[model samples]
Target: MGNHVETLRWNGSAIEMIDQRILPHRIEYIACDSAQSVAKAIRDMVVRGAPAIGVAAAYGVALEAILRKNEASNVFSTSLEEGFKALAASRPTAVNLFWALDRMRKLWETHQAKNQPELADIFLGTAHEILEEDIRINRAMGEYGASLLPDGSRVLTHCNAGALATAGHGTALGVFRSAVEAGKRISVFADETRPFLQGARLTAWEMVQENIPVTLITDNMSGHLMSRGEIDAVVVGTDRVAANGDVANKIGTYMVAVLAKRHNIPFYVACPLSTIDLSLATGEEIPIEERPVDEIKGFRDCHWAPEGVSIRNPAFDVTPAELVTALITEKGIVDNTTLTAGELADFVKKNQ
Candidate 1:
């Protein structure tokens, strides 16, 4: 396995997250002392990925509890509700964020009769559990996903789904790490995810750090490589998966899935159970977050596009379930190509 990277941690007083916005160049941590600060960090992308956001939001709820431990019951309850709403509004596409918040909220409601200090301790403990559980879940998903690739497989991935994206081991990248650990030779082709450039910066950096063979390609280069039979399989991490197994991932994921279908290459989505939202009937109902037009202009401060040109920047796109060969989950591998909404929902319920 690759070197374990701690994406975020609770230091007893504050939740500290690695600033993903300036990664691979400047290594910095943003200390969130309140739920508002944690929400801001999520909005600004100081910490990202579905699992990482969920864990961070868990800590955000705990931080709010700690911050309001000495306040009156009425004030404490009102302030905590405000914190929940702020975090819930930070990101719309990732179901894990709302999942974690709902879990914490339910726990708080169930134990609200306790004193404030005790309640704060319970929240902190639960947050710690969520963080640790995420790491375990990712490793399990890695094992299940790694089994899908044979020896000497060339895996193509989009964006950064490595350890930087999650709590410890990643989702999609975790499969590569796991396969390599099991004595399977796996090389990687990372897409230079545009605007943010997470793959060019974060994914390449992670693979290089762990001595895994990696090739960087522009976003448009995947189809060309696949046409040449250079790509073995496509593995990606999802922000959310609908009841019918429709996947919502990075903005370019749908194009990649369609290309994989044309090439007859297996396309896999490494998804955790928390990312699955059974309430959504289909991908058409998934809310796509439109980022600021400034992101389309250029990376950071380097602007290349001419000013005043309108840019539509949807942060993510949905891939139909039929395009997905399978979904590698912590419980097991889900055959998604022929999965029905009812079957998928039943699987989720059985697992839960």
Candidate 2:
């Protein structure tokens, strides 16, 4: 079941990505044969989620290498550099994008003396490695996080962090999947992540496909439900996590975290260490990507807002570490609730 949704895959000559923008309605794969095309897809959100973006960027570099495999060494190097910059520019908030590109760049630097074809093979192999590693890491995170939820747990999730969001499996939804696999009876409350409606479309669709009980509610309904004790825990996926444990995720994540704190409910961010930006001391240092105004106006081809109305469509928001109960990673869960100020930095230092 976890393998059913292939977010993106290399099909020998090109990168085939599931067109997430039309997901849960029509399953389509868009082939990207060049780094520029992959960058466009990432920027346009044809393939999203931090881990998935990272994997896509890695493949983007590989695609560039493949495209330039027959060129002169200097031309190949220049082209690869352009590819790196393009993928890096695709998204600002997801640290994993840069991480994956950096990993590929480092590998290229070490083996750059080789011919272009050999370098292309090395880059492609490394891209495949990153993809496989992401799946393994997500499964490990699922196992570690599944233990946190008791049987009959009612979990609240935002955005779409299921198999559709990653190479396979998921982060937040992976924990729910793991819990169900362990025979725990759990239900999910999916927030209809506004504008994009990832929750209402992707999350709900994934849950329903897996036969998991999922209830959909408007983005504004979380606080009310929490006040009524309908929510047991909140789990969401992050685009980036700071060294101090602050999180940058979907725009509504900050609100959900605040409400979870008010209800004394655990707010867990399921992410891989790749999403952690050690250079960023706090969430303030993380760059927020403001999406196009059309996203705020309405869904595709649907408009309700008045003409020339103002809009602030920041794709992400920061949640201070103080409000985060714990961070679920492949290594283990970091319990932020018990830590004093600045201790998350210590953890990052030790782990990093």
RMSD of each: 1.0, 1.3
Task: Score candidate 2 by TM-score against the native.
Answer: 0.97
Q: Give per-residue CA lDDT, model 2, range 212-265, as digits (tens).
A: 999999999999999999999999999998877889999899999999999999
Cα lDDT tens digits, model 1, 204-294, are 9889888999999999999999999999999999999999999999999999999999999999999999999998999999999998888
**TM-scores for every predicted model:** 0.98, 0.97
Q: Give the alpha-carbon lDDT of every model.
A: 0.92, 0.91
Best by TM-score: 1
